[model samples]
Target: MKILLLTPQFPYPPHQGTTLRNFNLIKGLARRHRLRLFSLLAPGDAPAGTPVTDLVEHLVTAEQPRRSMARRLRDLVSTPLPDMALRLWDPRNFDTLLEHCRAHPPDVLQIEAIEMAPYLFGLLAAGVRPPRIVYDAHNAETLLQRRAFLADVRRPRRWVGAVYSAIQTLKLRRYERRLLRSVDAAAAVSEADAAELRSMAPDLPLAIVPNGVDLSAYDPRHPYPNPYGRSGPNLVFTGKMDFRPNVDAALWFADRVLPLLHASNLGPHFWIVGKSPHPRLRRLRNRPDITITGAVPDIQPYLAHADLFVAPLLAGGGTRLKILEAMAMQKPVVSTRLGADGFPVQDGVQLALADTPARFAARCLELLQHPERAAELARRGHAFVTAHYGWEKIIPGLETLYSSNDTLTGASDRR
Candidate 1:
């Protein structure tokens, strides 16, 4: 099959969740199909000579459109579309897709995330005979926004952000329903996410295609350099620090959980590892116990060297690729239930799970003090992800979706 993939960003480095999913899906799909990728490049993102270039038959990129805050505010007041629908709206990208469809229509047009839904909308609005469109819901946007609203509403200081999310949640529901109904097939990263999407369009044909890791790249046996100099039982959380959920998670863990660990005299150093530390997080640099590495070339070293991986995410949708990466590295993990939302592992089987700050800290302390138990959990986690959460295991479901005659005809009839 010839597939045309649309992504919000170039998925080469795959450092972040969105890019990781897109990159792995492309790599897996390319094994049996011809792929042409159309991606919007973020500032400073370069695709030349990247491994992704080799995976696709052809690749095209356009600068991601810059939307001013004023424009976003204006849209919030005047438009029914969610913020995401307008985030990547660019005429050039629409024109590029149209032109390609006219000259070399693909067998399937696989839209990577909600941010890229504008192009699918554009193609349909233009009355072009689109190929079988596959909407890959990275997160059920409505559900994600709902979770954000719930998380932010309790804090008086964040009421403004809460209001924004509350409004976006409604807007996303309507927008997502239309997009799902229009697509030939849809995919969600997990059963939990798929359930949320199903609530929007009950009859929509959906498949579960969870996020996965490249096992070889995250091998526990690799000789990754110890990035934490002068560390005593380093606890690491990795993500794009600028991301709201990550920012929230890092702050929550540092403020509420780390102090508890300290009070117990466990004295574990916390490392926030990723690119683009938020201003709120950057302020923590003054603290001697916390080391905020702004950006690292590779995250494997951080994961490999960590004594424990902590995910204290309070508000986020989708299964965390960071957790999977950590597990693939054979490191013990302690996460909030929300952080481990979509995975099927038991609380003590794969990794420890806790909700409250004290419990979270206790779990970390327990794992830190018991090397044998930690190693057991780490081994189980490694085996669990290796058996289930690999690109090779996840990609076949997507391929099956693409090849299903019922999915193709059923979607075309709806249109």
Candidate 2:
């Protein structure tokens, strides 16, 4: 099959969850299908001569549009479309996509996330005949916004953010409904996400294709230098630090849970490793116990040296690829129940689970003190991810969706 994949960012390095899913899917599908990618390039992204270029038949990119805070505020009142719908809105990308379709039409148009949904909607609005379109729901956007609103409304300081999310939640529901209804089929990252999308468009054909890790790249046996040279039981939590949920999780853990660990006389060090550290996280630099490394060349070394991987996420939708990467590296994890939502692992068997700050601190302290117990959980966690969450295992489900005759024929009905 000839497939055209559209992404909100260049997926070469696969540093974060969205890119990890997009890059791996492209790699897997390239084995049997002719794949082409149309991506938006963020300011710092350099994609030329990357491995991703070798995976696809052709690649095209456009500058990701930037909207000022003033413009976004204007949009909140001026347009009914959600913030995501306008995030990557650019005429150049739409024109590029149309040019490619005319020259080398694909059998399927696979969009990565809701941020890229604008291009699909554009093609339809232009009255161009589209191929079988598959809307990949990285997160059930509406549900994600609703969760954000609920989480933020509880904190008096976050009322402004809560109000913003409340508006996006309503707008996203309407946008996602139209997107799902217009596409021939949709793919979801988890059963939890699939259920949410199903509620929006019950008749929409949806498939569950959970996010996965590249097993070879995340091998536990590979030796790495300890990124934290002077560390004493380094607790690591990694993600795009600028992301709302990650910023909130990092702050919550440092402010609420870290104090408890210190009081327990553990003398533990916390490492927040990832790109784009939010300005809000800067206050954590005052403590000598915390290290915030922004945009490291690689994350595996940090995970390799971690005494325990801690995910104190209070709010987010979709399964975390960072957790899968840590598990594949054979690291013991302690996360909130919500952090481990979509995975099917037992609390004490694969890793520890705790929701409250006190419980989370206790769990981390226990794992750090007992190497033998942590090793057992690490072994089980690695085995679980190897068996179920590898890209090789997850790609076949998507392949099945691509080959289905019903999906190909259903495009006409949506049109």
Candidate 3:
């Protein structure tokens, strides 16, 4: 079948979570379907490797919009939609998507994330009829924004973060609901998000196509004994540093959890690895024990070298791709329930789940001190992902959605 995949960003290089997920899915589906990827890439942020054009039928890159004051004012007043204010204002992206659809009318058009839904929905209204409309619900953007708003409760300065987030949340929720009603099928990384989408539209054709990793590229043995490991025992937290949830998680761990572990005779080093280290994260850099590597070329080494993988994320949407990747790398992960969503692995057998600071720190300490138990947990986690969350296992189900003509039960039986 001929398929068109619309993405918010260039999926090559695979540095960020969304990019990695899209890249893996495209690579997997390209093996079976005639795929054409139309991605909106930010100006000057060229992906390191060749574009998706070589592997697929076609690849179109659209310039993203700049967040200027004029844009903000226009967005607040005259925008038809929230995402339109943020992204669709760029006429080039709209033209690019429409042009591609006209040039090659695909059997299925898979909107990869919430951000791209605006363009896809707009194109559909403009009479772009692709029989199969698969909304790849990466995350419930509304819920994510809601969480962000809630997390800002303690701010005394009274920033407009909450108000802005709420506005975006409401706007996106409406857009998502409309898309759910209009689209042939929808898929999310987590059942929780699928449930949320279903709540918006009772009969929304929804499925759970999870975020995935390339197993071959992220082998544990390949990146073991990393350069960053020579210091004390490393406890690593990996994600986009500027992300609010990740920032909150890292701070929660450092301020609330680390002290408890420190008191318990666990003198562990902390490595927070990701791009765009926020100011809050910079504060932790003063301590000799904490090192913030702002955007390394590769993260596998950091994961392999670390004694433990820590994901204390308390607020966010969608499954934690970092948690899954750590599990796939056979690392003992200590995370909150929120951090380990969607992947149904036993807490004690595959990973350690602790919501509170004391319990979270204790879990990390337990995994660090007890090598046998940690190894067993890591082994079990890897085994679980190998069976359930592998790209090979999940992609066939997605392929069925794209290929199957039935609207009511779009390849649900195969799972």
Residue 341 error for model 1, in Å? 0.7
Task: Tell how far residue 244 is off in model 3, in angstroms.
Answer: 1.4
The global C-alpha lDDT for each of the candidates, from Candidate 1 onward, is 0.88, 0.88, 0.79
lDDT per residue for candidate 1 within 166-275, as digits (tens), equals 99999999999988888878888777788898888787777777788999899999898888887578999999999899999999999999989987676789999999
Q: Please report the TM-score between candidate 2 and the true structure.
A: 0.96
Model 1 residue 190 lDDT? 70
Report lDDT (Cα) of residue 114, candidate 1.
Answer: 94
lDDT of 2 at 356: 93
Q: How accurate locally is residue 185 in candidate 3, as Cα lDDT from 0 to 100?
A: 80
Q: Which residue runs of candidate 1 sit more than 4 Å off their true CA positions?
A: 407-415
TM-score of each: 0.96, 0.96, 0.92
